[model samples]
Target: MVEINSLDENDVLFGVVASDRKNRWLGMHVDHDQTPPLPWWMSNPNQMPQWTNFLPGESNNHEYHGETRVQMRKPTGKWNDVPCDKKLKCICEININ
Candidate 1:
């Protein structure tokens, strides 16, 4: 998996290599000019940080890319480790009924 600031072919290639080396997706290539350290709120020592939960009124749109191996975000803005295709990107919906 890989994450880039923008979807450029070159950036995606680099991110893939970096992800393979680290065995996890590093959102935004570390070589980016303005790459920032992972925030304290997202830190996890056991495994890659999985995006979960949503603050009230948070925007529904996101620019994230690459494999969804770790978490899948629901339309309601809650993320969980639901199994899905390990593709470049995907959207999963569940019927509450």
Candidate 2:
């Protein structure tokens, strides 16, 4: 995930990579940018942005495009099994110092 500064004066930007099944190249971009109280998308669902569909034993067939890939799974709890398209309330945090 790439962390960036938010365009807004009170926000901080966070970028993450997401992929589809078969480990194909999907896309990369910022998930959200907000201020203090850290966005729910950060911890609530525990859905850290990551590259998906990376099945083991298939790395030989995978191509490296110089993009950083991290393995992340959906959080198991109230947020588990929720559709990605569903919208939910979230918060954002900013460093004071």
Residue 82 shift from truth in candidate 1, angstroms: 3.4
Model 1 segments more than 4 A misplaced: 1-68, 83-85, 88-97
How well does candidate 1 score on lDDT at residue 73?
33
Decoy 1 TM-score against native: 0.21
lDDT of 2: 0.25
**Candidate 1 structure quality by residue, lDDT tens digits, 1-97:** 3222233532444444444442222221111122332211112333423432323422222334321233313222222221224333432223368
Clashes of 2: 7
Question: Candidate 1: deviation at residue 25, Å?
Answer: 9.1
TM-score against truth, every candidate: 0.21, 0.19
Prediction RMSDs, each to the true structure = 15.7, 15.5
